[model samples]
Target: MSEEIGRVGGPKNVREALLISSETADRNRHEIYEFGPFRLEPAERKLSRGDEVVTLTPKVFDMLVMLVRHSGHLLEKDDLIRSLWPDSFVEEGNLSNNIFVLRKALGNDREYIETVPRRGYRFVGAVRQLPPTGRNAISGVLEGQIRDVPSRQTRRGWKILFAAAAALLLFAAVFILRRFRGENSASSPNSPHLAVEQRLTSNPSDVPVRAAAISADGKYLAYADPTGLYLSQISSGETRRWSLPKDFVVFPRSWYPDGAHLLVVRDPKHPLDSSLPNPSLYKLSILGGEPQKIMSNAWGGSVSPDGSRIAYLSHTNAGDLWIMDSDGANARKVVAGPDPNKGGAGQDLIWRVVWSPTGQHLAYIQAHYRNAPDPVEPISSLRIVDPDGGGASVVLEDARLGPVALWWGREDRILFSYREDPANAQRNYGVYSIRIDGRTGKAIGPPQAVTRAEGFIEGMNGTPDGKRLVLWRLRVPAQVFISDYDPGTRQWKEPRRLVLDANENLAWVWTADSKAVFFVSNRNGTWKLFKQAIDETSPEVLVEGPSISDPRLSADGTQVLYLSSSNPDDASFPAEVMSKPIAGGTPRVVIQGKGIGNFQCAMAPSTLCLFSRDGGDYVFRVFDLEHGAGRELLKLQHQVWSENGSWSLSSDGSKLAIFLDQHRIRFFSIATGAAQDVTVKDWPLQNGDWGANSQTVFMPSHSPAGVPVILEVDQTGKAKVVLQGKPNADFGWMIQSPDSRHAVLGEYIPTDNNAWILNDF
Candidate 1:
């Protein structure tokens, strides 16, 4: 019997029985099976309870089908495994895992599949099979019975049937109407507007606004634009600049409920010093008075709807949420951050906490630790919990990189800003809203996009009525400039703008001959590699694609290596390391993985190319371009922050410099798997690259007092300022020539950020 069951060709009687069973199953494939309120269709591979379809994995669905095929009969464990995973070997644990997942997908109907202890499983639920026209046949018989009886119950049934038919007709009509309107809106110019935005403050001097807030009554707006705090009245269109102490810098965070006082964060330490004063919260009055300190060590805070208590974020090992009385008393931690001692998984940092309208719940952002097997991407979730730290749950699990600003609006919805393309900084940021589940503190409906605007929406606030919104729009213009740096004199001179097209042009590298420069730009809508000679004004396109980044020229100057995304718009697309001839031809893929960034090749002495792949921690590899192979050299002890741009390769490609957390720099040798830490007096390093001698690294450092300076650090970590930026000017990434005599730096062109009020949002 076992042989007959397993063999394809068997005895005549057995073959006939098997063929009959197969034909019967095929004939009933499209038939609907009903058990209780659940319905299953074998042909569609779908299971539904009344109107909602339940999602299931492919294996689980197959297992459910097998169980239902043998309903009321106990199937042995081995038989079930053979039936489900017939072609491969699988552990009993996998079967059990699938059963568990299947039960979860079944929800309340999980009891239908009963586990027979020490043996197998059984589908105990009584199921009835129905033909294609079963419902219509039953309805026709009911109509005949009702006509024969002519009772009140029959009349009531007829009324219910008519009502349901009307409802179905109405729903179909509405769905068609919505589809028609959507199609027309895509092609029509006179479509209905969803939102109207108006710019509030236009500074003639082009000072970029940092943090902004609107008053509760929507009558006044306060913002910081590098200089100081400014207050503007919406009704009068008059602006007032408030004076501050010379040593203190204030960033407006939130406005007091009373509308007369604003909550601000102050930094009082000297900008050039290495040590900074702890950020403190204060109450600055709009009526012009000395600011009064409220909290000793807090940066962001939000007041309750009743203005009685405040929820604030305090800096510890990681940011944590805290609650305190309005007068700064009875402070306590509510949401604990990740512990430094506990290494993997649950470690998360909290940021951007905001209170619900009734102050019953607080929503914040949590960044989780990077896990292995997947690429190192920024993993964040929007979470909500009780103010006293209870009933916590994640509302949105895949929040992208941005400012993490969230505002609770009407109808229990939260509006937030996120970036769709983490690789392309030039892409527009979008705003989305998700409905909050009141009972479980989770998100209920799908997130709907409100708008996608150019640049970034840094800060957002809503009026008391939740009808008007104020947002800060920031656009930073980046351009490449060539300057001469003399390592001997430690002076920078004759800085000239290299690219004048006004789009973001960065990640510039010199060719082996130092005659031309190669960089990545998004001037043509998609990120592509472009090259131009040192003396030329125009750049020629080298490689054009939808998702290309981190361009590198090989040591022989014959090939250009870069990371290309199969689908740039899809975050799950794994990036591939591709190499193409510098002169131009078909590109060849070398390595395939996630989180591929920051690659370099030796200038002339060697043909080694170094690249880094990020999983949880960064793994650096050295690839021999000639042999088309590579090996891992070292892995970082900690995960590199994606936004920091922390790793750099030396010109000779012998040593790699990595800036790690806790103000530490690691100089790793490629030949030997040895690393040495470079100590720089606890100075925070932004971004830098190696000098021509390969012994010193030139990096940008900002002082505690917010002063930006270019520093040259030796192999031993001794550092000295090579170039000082203007007091308030922001310095971007810096790249140098092979001889260290010439370099190009990104100096941010001043951009004016204005606060806009969006009505009917």
Candidate 2:
């Protein structure tokens, strides 16, 4: 109902309201009723969701009012079609699709409009009806009326109403909190943490060793520490702390889909500690129980959809056909035996394991064969296997395709990420999908590419309905966006910016309306609550937002919530946790931990807040930023020394990708308590970019003896030289362009003592 100013000014005055109503009165076809929380000037056609301007296609807005005015009646399919498309011939399906799309853009308030079975649609919510007031009540209000309005309510009555409103708000908060927890199914089988860190200066924080994972029920999240594990409650502010034995180093690897336990990799000594001893995987628990050893050879691990089994790649010498149930008593090899070509070695070097949504098959990575550590190893291919462990084969492989990501869905279909390089081999990766059991394990091509430039995919969690695919893309400095994955069309819609600001780090939640995005941003210098209309041509900022990151939208999209800092100005550190409205209003702080930097926050599928506590030690703590009850999952002895580690959470929140020191990277499984080094030997210099899918890392590598070239690495652990020319090329200073279409090569021209942008190779 709020009106947007063309530029910037105060609220709309009485004269303007009168002018608007009078102008629309002549064409008042059916007494058009337009009103919301504050006020709106329909005739001006300018709408505001608080202080931000909401841009909308003219038609989308028109459709909105038509439904609003008809507040409580069903508008049959044909009935509305006739009114809207009177002059044109359109199909019923088209009308239905348009209505559906419009609803998505309008956001959660669509509750006012109800879907009426096979009949049509109805607007059932209350409408703030505006009256003509013959004498113009707003502008032409008499002095007596103004006096009477205030006199009607005494100071005490006003106080009572304010108190009642506050109480009701509190009750509503409780209801919504319970609803989200209950609906998301505290035990839903998916929990992926979205990690966002901004490298503000020339020097970035040591690549963060942050780890994230979700409980089998999607409620609990386990994160890594240099020394231990931290268990956090996703919905309620709750947490439990776990410390690894002093002698045995532990790191989380995977979370059982069952949500009750975890699988961790425990090493008597660090595997990278001496770079000789092999790492092993062990199963851990969150409900407080003894850990059981799973595999001595397992590294990058994954749990099956049924939760009865596990899969992981053994050491290079061990066969890689994907050992299943590698945890339980019935554990055995699942995929076919290793490839015979390489002396009957492993069949795949599994990076990401996507269990079929319907629980039929699995898709994983098959690293390429290499005799030496040349930076030109291509991706082997994608391998699909059944749970029973036998019908396994390469589903996609080509000279151009590189192993990126593999995600399984209902019909044994696999959604993967790869790059298409016709020749030079500097192929940039993008999102794609394919059926595992198709004809030959050849290139069937991806349905849609998620990113154009070398963008990294942070989180890709499918919606409960399986219609929407939520993803996070990171460039430099950082930007958060949302894209709609429509399986029916097999096309990925262009991604829309979720958070308005581009320079800051952002994490968000999507409501029912694809456009109404609620996210947390550092636009205010510190993280804060911010909401915008994803559908609106121009989104309006709902609230100033709290200093929080990792925001999750309720499944229905009605609420925009997130964890807030326990305190805004502790001076010691960030606030604990808090939440507020996506539509912009007051915020409620939920958790207040002493000496905690509330700024450390990550949001997985579960709505819990994952934050870091940096002080005496680098601590990863999880709590329902809203309810304030959770514990620590793990802590690392090296956590304190590590500064800028980029932490990433797996979709299921079972695995965490921690990039410590731009060159050293590791993946810790929350389930296995195992931390495996993903760092490639001599991985160029420091600070480059995270390739598409997040798994593929792109960093400028110097060919010590040859030309200085930029190398690209895939999830398969294979690397390829992407660019080369000048010796000692400003590698660390090189940056990706805004459009990502071109990379800026910052070079200091010795002749002129000036820097030039290399537009030409």
Writing each residue's lDDT as its tens digit, candidate 1 over 49-99 gives: 889998888778767765665455455677667656667999999999998
Task: TM-score for candidate 1, please give it.
Answer: 0.69
Between which residue pairs do clashes occur in model 1? 270-705, 271-705
Task: List CA RMSD, all candidates.
Answer: 21.1, 26.7
Pick out the ten consecutive residues of candidate 1 with the lowest summed lDDT: 1-10
At residue 132, what lDDT does model 2 achieve?
52
TM-score of each: 0.69, 0.36
State which candidate has the highest TM-score. 1
Tens digits of per-residue lDDT for model 2, 1-761: 32211111111321222233334433443232433432333444554556755665655455455555444434566656665655677888876776777656556533345554345665554556555544343442233446555654576787899798777656644433333222234544443211111111111122222334544444555655433567766445365667455555565555666566777666533232224346777777665656677777666566665666676765544445455564445555665445534334322345555566555666676664321111123355677677677566766665344443444533535555555433322233455556443434343544444323333333233322233332323233344444444556634344344444443434323343333445444443344455555445344455443335445543223445454433222333344344555545576665665434322222234343455554444466666544564788666543322233335443334555555653566666666878777556644344344432334555555553424455666544566765554432233322222222323232211110100000000
